[model samples]
Target chain A: MFKELNHLDELSRRKFIQYSAKAMLGVGLASTSNNLWGSQIIGKPTAKSVIYIYLSGGMSHIDTFDPKPGWEQQGPVQTINTNVAGIRVSEYLPSLAKRMDKMAIIRSMTSTQGAHEQGTYFMHTSYEQRGTIKHPGLGAWLNTMSGKTNSTLPGNIRIGGSNNAPGGAGFFDSKYEPLHLGDPNNGLPYIKRHQSISEIEMQERLAIAQMMDLSFHQKYPSKKVQAYSDVYDEATRLMRSEDLQAFDLNKEPQSVRARYGDTKFGKGCLLARRLVEHGVRFVEVTHGGWDTHNDNHELVSNLSNPLDQSVSALLDDLHLRGLLEETLVVIGTEFGRSPKINVNSGRDHHPKVFSCVLAGGGIKGGQVYGASDESGHSVAESPVTVPDFNATIAYSLGLPTDKVVYSPSGRPFQVAHKGQALTGLF
Target chain B: MPLSTPQLRSFVFGLALLAGPLASPAEEMAMEEMQMDAMMDSMQMDAMHGMDETSIELFDAAKAVLNSYCYECHGATKQKGDYRLDQKSTIYSPGESEELPVVPGKPDESALFKRITLDIEHDDVMPPPKKARLKEAEIKAIKDWIAAGAIWTDEDVRSGLPTTYVEIGDEATNALIDKINETRAKAEYNAWGDNSVRVDLSVTDKDKLKEAIIGLKDFGTRLAWIDCSYLELSESFYKNISQYQNLERLHLDNSNVSNEDLKALSDLPKLNYLNLYSTKINDDGIAALAACKSLNKVFLGSTKVTKAGVEKLQAANPELTIIYK
Candidate 1:
């Protein structure tokens, strides 16, 4: 029984599991509930939540945020003013350009890891891919630090990403793991039980399973075992949760849906907006196929349309409901493509210099931070490293990046691993 | 693609064996030792190239110390040594001393940076012998600030914030205001620049929401935005909420707020965004809100608000964006 639930004996049908203990492990195995509580928040946070938009493949900076016009490296892509004076982006982002007053573009993002897997892992966890130990991603750290504001819902969610994606609850408590959602359009798969299986029978099966694995789990007590057991408990609670409507895209009106458009990416954006609106701490929506190694211009232009439309609508909708100030909308990628146009008229992987964007969350708007050279080949001034960029994100959430948490094996690790935040961005 | 008998085993059967789930603890410890050594070497390499502090961070710390301690003497009011540290230009300008106050990239040459670190026994040490001495941390902050280039940051965005409705109210009114402000949502004033007040209650509890909201009627004048979207009972709960003259953005989505409840909001001059999604409010509600000329965006999703009702609102306020579905 929760210490706070004495007054509320009967659970309401609408708002179930508002007490966090019921939302996590304490509900299932009630015995081993001591260490599974969410950490009390420490610092005064700037952003209450974050929407991490991860572009899985390397997005081309020269063709997007950093348009090097008149320089041949820019290729055939035209540039337009971004409403803010002296700032211009690719022609494809006309809608975003008009609302540039709400965004800050970082043009000199550089990274050392060039391959897709390594770079993606590095960006997510802010550390090199080491064989010895896995590191927790930003989501895991966030839940571990402040807990979830919406205690009934999952602490964090990742939409449109691989099931075995990098930056999961690595080496962290399994309760802090993100609920991997494959598509915003689809409901939580297998959330409902079989019609024939009675509730009592399901509870019996779960108890028997817990008893059978009790000894083995106690003997080793590894992160994997904790994660496995906790996942089952999470799903059982989630199945009965009424807030499950947060996942159902159909709840949004058709007009609202049409404004974001028909692409899965657009739906994913709308889902991100809804989840954050419900007080979920962190949400990451991954949009892939950005690795434009061939037919760069056409492929990027096609991709840019959905990205522009959905993000613009998302920004507008958030402002409409007055959520833009506290919700941090971030556009991040593993790395950017090469500046040089290849024989296939496509750009290859280039980790030397790229671009990312930040908006809302107390960030200064209508400004560009750092810059690449005229040809967009290398960082010319104020080069921001991958860890530094992520550190700024942590800073917005009031996360103490200097404080280190020890892994299971007692290895020290910080959120961004000693990366200094760009304080001026605030 | 048929599976063989050997390949047809249940996943539970395979997992029950527990083949040391991803490496045993002993083996992990053994492997981790070698990795730690390699990581130590990398840490040294990083130390050679990594920055201790960025220029902006140094300046932020240094200026904070200056504003806290030195500002009393060498600030807007009084400049004891004919040195004003308020403006960036005045900070760099040479005062009585022949040495420059700040040398940008070279902090060792800057007189301001040097004075704070000078020996207390010396006559020129900052804060003087009679005043409180600077802490080691404060000195370090000053050093780092100068090392990163003493560039000044502009912090003028916090001006023109909303002023309080009552400057000096009665004890009962002030007490009522305090009670209303208990746990009210607030903007991140420190991050935004100043202690400017901006109220937002987008996500609040439904426990005593009725009484608490009725309480807001006393001091609700400060609120421009309030969201009652997901609450269970949002019907005539708008006791005195409609009379809140400064209510700019209001969300009663997925509720039972009626036409009469919205009718009182028709005269608000600054109401910009209103969301009445999934509510029982119909054409009468839209008609009641038609006089809101300042209304810019409105969401009527899943409501009985029809095209004719929307036309009535738009006809009165042409700039109104009616998202009716």
Candidate 2:
């Protein structure tokens, strides 16, 4: 049942590495399956779902979670004391400040990749961009490990038009891929019958497709070839399901809608909360426009409003629904902006250090982990790499970060490559 | 910045790869764990025997290891060659092959033991070549159990519950677990690597949900979380559930539960979380929760509980997260 542990045999470690890649990756994988081991979950599940709020472009560490009030790097945005004693945030994020007790902020996040595409890709996949191979994102890894709690819904639903640098499903099967939703306001497009095709007609089309896929499957019996059939079955089940209303935002009351605000990111956060309650494993809501290369203060402060309002509302909403205990809410970004204001009165890209915040899912909130220097120039203590941060998130969900999952071409990869999870966070 | 020698540059690049306090990634790498999986698997089996006590833990651990290897073909799913190891009664007897799979206190006489200790190349190896062969630690753990009287516990490997704490395998808790599983209410281990079970009675049909909660009484000390969300809970349900002395989290959200139901929960001194969202409970319920000094977080969203009540609760205990709309 566990592929990670079944390689023990007469083959020595050095000899196995020297052996052909296919000999190692595909030799004995088919001998085990979910039916064999997954039914009996030895450990009780924790962090059943993840709502990753990705702030696209670069978020400024000095202007948000980590405020450097006395330094010149601290711009016009004043630092305000949070509800938690000694913790402070940007004045623009007053709402988030009042709810800081529920957050554990990490101030010393560093990454190697600096460019937008590479930085975003590294943050999402925990691997540096390589032209030879695309890496699977965290959502794909979670889907592969623990199939979603709700079988009728898709395992992962990504709600923004963010960059595809996360590399959809990597070398995994298509069934493990995410269902990308373009506009949050649209509420799961093309899900319902078009009002033209009847139910009988839909069934007829599916039967015909299956008949054709049978011959195709016979011709190519590889795992990926058979994954096509799984996708068709999943889509058919989703369309016929009574639980698809989990994606419908119209069900929310006007008061609740207003509380999350009318913005797209706000709408996305609300949609994420709704999907998680219905048992979707992972939901990524991307809020763009943080690329404030020019009017740093004005744009960042403006962006912080929707972020603060929507996230605060999300935390409160999840807690009220009793989902926060098992659902992890993460605020992540590609990297942080420069501590030194640029010639355009804006902060340039700073990949040296940044900040990220996580709450609930067994994390001890009302505390800060790691730290940046006084001027936010470098990681001063508990320097967490990009992989370490991602591994920590995976750890909260009880996933084995070190377990090797071989790519189709025989390259071994992990949820976070060689990353050590910060076990202290829990 | 200093690239003096070719070897020095390569060493610096390698140093950068080792991040955080991970001074030596090579030493801690899973390359050392290629054969350790078999060892760890057997260790986890022993882990279910509970606590720091080693000898008795190894006894249960050995049985658990046997279950891990043999149960897939012989337990609950398929009976390959008419042999089964799932039952405590079946392991000691002979199978369709007319050979004794196990014999009490005699490893040499047992066919199962002989097959596992056979050479890997031999077809008689217990797992065959399809599955990985048992490592030395796993074989020794089993061998030691047979050297002693191989006493099988009636409770081991029976509902797929990991008995992390020894006391959790008591008769009352065992019966409660079976009842919860049979009811389809989703009883599960409270945390990974722990023995305590949390029951979620949040099924459709309010009557069924109520019956499931009230059906089991005296759930012993290991019951951790009880989810009674989205139901018309009766007074009897609350009274019956409050007897779980070690209850930690309770989910009674979006139900028709009243302030009086709050009074019933006072007996649960270890209760940490209470979800009363959308319920009609008022200030009295908040006061009742406040009185349970071990409370960590309480949800009062859309409930009739006034702001004054929440204020009183928070003012009394600053650590509690008083969640409200």
Which model scores highest in TM-score? 2
lDDT tens string, model 2, B112-175?
A: 8898899888977888778877888999888887777565544212222211222123455546
Classified by CAPRI criteria, candidate 1 counts as incorrect
Which digits, one per residue and each the tens of the lDDT, describe model 1 over residues A1-426? 222332332223112332332342122211233122222233445677898889889899989999989786687789998889999999989999988999999999999999999999999998888886788899888777545555357878999979777888877666777888887889578677789889988788777767766765554343444556666676776777667788889989999999899999899999999898877879998989999999999999999999899999998887655567678899999999998889998999999999999998778889999999998889999999988998998888877676545454324567887777888888
Give me the runs in candidate 1 sitting further than 4 Å from their true place: A1-43, A207-229, B1-228, B233-325
Top-scoring candidate (lDDT)? 2
What Cα-based lDDT does every candidate model obtain?
Answer: 0.71, 0.72
lDDT of 2 by residue, A194-283 (tens): 698798887776676566446444543434334545656777778876568888999999999999999999999999998987668799
Check candidate 2 and list the clashing pairs. B46-B61
Clashing pairs in 1: B58-B145
DockQ for the candidates, in order: 0.03, 0.09
